[model samples]
Target: MMIHRLGTMLLLIGIGALPAQSQVAPLAPSDITNIPPDPALKNWSVRTVQIPMRDGVKLNTIVILPRGIKNAPIIFARTPYGAEKALTGAPSNDFRLALPTSYADLAAAGYIVVVQDVRGRYGSEGDYIINRPLVGPLNDTKVDHSTDAYDSIDWMVKNIAETNGKVGTIGVSYGGLTTLYSIVNPHPALRAAVPINPLVDGWMGDDWFHNGAYRQSFLDWVYRMSADKSSKYALQFDRQDVYESWLKAGSVSDMAKQLGVDTMPMFRKLVDHPAYDEFWQLQALDKRLGKEPLKVPTLHVHSLWDQEDIYGAPAAYAAMEPKDRGNDENYMIIGPWRHGQGMVADGSKLGAITFNGNSASWYRQKVLIPFFDRNLKGSADPGIAPVTAFETGANEWRRYDRWPMSCASGCPSRSKPIYLSSGGGLGWTSPTGAGGFSEYVSDPARPVTYRQRPILGTYNPLTTWGQWLVDDQRFAEARPDVVTFVSEVLTDEVRLAGQPIAKFFASTSGTDSDWVVKLIDVYPAEYAEAPEMGGYELAISMDILRGRYRESFSKPAPIPANQVLPYEIKLPNVSHRFLKGHRIMVQIQSSWFPLYDRNPQKFVPNIFTAQKSDYQKATQRIWTSARYPSRIELPVMP
Candidate 1:
């Protein structure tokens, strides 16, 4: 059972979180008998070392090289999955590991690769604190993996031989985040870097919540896995039969029984800290990394379909690269796959669709390799475009000087912010004068979580976790329970980039209620596009919130029953371009199932303390008037 839990969590992290090949074995020095180097690899060596951190933790790492060598100049990838394991993979992420042949091949070309386990986890010594640790009000220690990262690289440069006194780093997801954090200290010897789909912040608002609402499923699965490290609930956890039973039973609302029995303490802690308050502010890379100017050339990689840590990658790109510096140097890529899945596809996998039929080889040969080569090998710039996005249906790469419409750089006509009228229409003519208001009754009994399974075998599990993929507002629209305001079909193209903020000037009948802002690209009434790969039409969507944890993330306050509360939540950013004849849809509802924990409508010390009887069905109001305008503020191409 414990193995099942670990296995389940492993699935969440899986190939998506870790790099690939086969999981490497931890062996003693006697086992270091060198295997003959593949002909392709002539210059590097495989060496093992213990990197000592300030806190007396000796982290383990492996240096992979081209031949029998000393410091061939290092490119590091630090992971929580263990140093040797960093380069390996689970059965699924198998192919991503550079084969002995590929390594030999790259080595023949020349570049040393080093991998390490972070401060804890795997063979490392310190306690693994999951992510960039929290030095919040509860615990005020101005220390984290950031400091440890700095210290280790500081040590590696001086001691390692082949290193001409410099290092470059790269990785996808977790490793990618490590790369960004490692470079922030800007080791004197560090040259260049790349971070793909990195987890941006620990703020419940970002990683685990979409607008004050708790994002479940993926978070639930991950937390449970992290808690036990073994699978006590493996059978019931993975079995679809048991899934329904658990679903019928309850979601995390009954965490003690339905799923995570041991994770409540931490879960409550996360729920308690809902906003980007001091707790999240401290752990977030945004705050920490910003304090220092990013001087290195970085390639921000993201998957268009990426569901995990999707919010962070793009934001980091916008951040590290100075907007003032307009150059091809700070590049970005968004592919057709999710969670970096398509990045290493041979095709047979990826739900029911086989990416193998249509794989992007350029990623391996032209992009990633060339990147490591250019930086570590000190080769000239490869002339790759600044922005390369894979157009889904086209399954082809499109290059641009910047994200969104390149030509619209200085265009003024396209920049416009449409408003959501109370009655459900969009634009200036949507009627704001006479009685601009609407209501919805939120019932906690039928709380909406994600419709798909939590782990694999589920569709769009990361971002769509806890929420159903086919969240057609049609059902909610029919229910007097959901308030949806949509824009008219655009006559021309309008591209929105950067984060979009939704300002809700309204009130709620309940002491605590959640307002979910979902930005969706609504298909035409009679239009339907065939599924690009999974036979499911792509529904590009992202959301954010307003809830009980309004002004204070750490502290909680009720809505005062019938009083109005002005709320605003910065929805996830979108690089979407609304073309001719398409309508922009904004869905505001108080409920999203299992993907988010059900919000108990009554005001109590904590929702956790509320009884089932306290779960009341409360009314919500949307006041759309000139005085209290509730609208989405989008960043135009400019």
Candidate 2:
């Protein structure tokens, strides 16, 4: 009876009428297939091809040619992300808009842009290994990123119709890693390389881990990358607050299992090897690239507030500097950017902090473009210095003959110790009193969140991952588990141009612990300029060190319970000025929350596999005295 009533209703509505069928008729072949070309893309020619590697694997490559191009040099980029999307996703008559924003100046300068998908990603063929190690001890396979890069360059120079055979490699993050790999056994046509925020060492400081503390947030990325060749999938969460999600997920291993990423090779390796083992050491790009003399003119771009891969640019530059005997081939650009923002966005401001001008645009037009023209196009001198750094507080750029003249090997920079004293004070002089310590109770159950609560996923559109480095530190300073040591208002500006070393005469009641040190710039309480920034605590440089690996990064051992020990934490490089009327601050804590996996406090063989019971509250102490003066050695610029 219900079926009969439904049929009568359909007949009354004329659901299958002849006129309705005509209205829903399929589009004509010409109407569907022959669409007018975008007027905006009229000046650009875009095409894709499968370029074969030495191993017979075909990588999907996109070649973009500018209008009326002739004898043009090639700007090449290899990436795991989709080449088609990166190179030609947006169709525009303006060549600058046709490519990534970072390459805008180069795009206007008229060069053949080539982008390709690395093996086993996107449209490329072959198994994808995250940061595939070079063909050496760690990887017995002949096909690696370096080899693939060599083959790709060889193919491009030989097959492309462009007259000029010169090629320059440039990319950021993973793509930046590929750019570095290209210079390993560079192709004859390869002239220049720009590795911006490249992934150099995973276990030491880059992605995955920083000084043995795992960045568990990267698990979502791993799951997405390894799930399939396409970028369609994303890790979903039942809760919007990632801090809560991670806290409730228990151990890193448990998180992996719950996400069902435990079976992935990358996740398994991360879980299996929590320490800096041979697996990681052998894959370090700096160690590998530094072994040979510099073959290509390379420019290393480092972001001052690079939330990810902060240690890579300087580390790689330091390793390769000695090889550049003439000092003309190796160059470094340090910008006030978060990750790849230097190339991708207007660098006028970050968060609430504003640079006087568009720093990124200036860098691209004045520095990056000229660098490429000199090496790739055989242009005259661009007058680029060995080090081009953006001074944060000063809101300007400075040229230096060499970088970190105060801290690097055989450099002239002096290391001035700023002692952490009692009463939450920081001073240039050593403490004269007897041994005294500042104490805090570190509980794993309530690990301090790296940022304010309701932290989003690493790659989430609304995630603070990019700007968190420059985020105000007042949130962390307000916590009880976190200890703050602030200096008196400066009478004169204090400039720092190199790495800051934190010397902690510290101890933990438990057998294991973690130490997080932050160097901050405290603004004045009352200010006319940017009133909202009043009393802001801006972190200049910060890093974490797992206590087990304090003695040796490769080895892990438990701390002596309740015993005083000296741990040296090397903070990332910085170029900043503590303006007069401002204060210098240092905040030390045991946990950076789900950002870095919580230290069990109770020593376990492997933190990844540790049980919930392994986590406990421990009394952590920081000693200050003439004999054991806990201080941060700042590379104060003369």
TM-score of 2: 0.94
Candidate 1 minimal-lDDT segment of 10 residues: 530-539
Cα lDDT tens digits for candidate 2, 1-638 = 99999999899788656575467667566747666777564777777889998778999998888777879899999989888776544666666776778655666787888889999998999999888888878789888888888998888888888749999999999989999999998888999999999999998898899999999888888988989887677788768898888889899888888888889899888877888889988888999887977999999999999988998999899999998888799999999999998887589999978999999988888889899999988999888988899999998788876788733234466789999986799999888879588899999999988888789998788887888888888989888999999999999998899999999789899999999999999999987788999999999999999999978888899999988899998999999999999999999999998889999998899999889988999999998888888999999886
- Per-model C-alpha lDDT, please? 0.60, 0.88
Residue 568, candidate 1: Cα error in Å is 2.7
Error of 2 at 619 (Å): 0.6
| Cα error, candidate 1, residue 314 (Å) | 3.6
Which pairs, if any, clash in model 2?
A: 40-93, 405-413, 406-413
lDDT for 140 in candidate 2 is 90
Predicted structure with the largest TM-score when compared to the true one: 2
Model 2 spans > 4 angstroms off: 1-33, 38-41, 87-90, 406-411
Point to the candidate with the largest lDDT. Answer: 2
Displacement of residue 475 (Cα, Å) in model 2 is 1.0
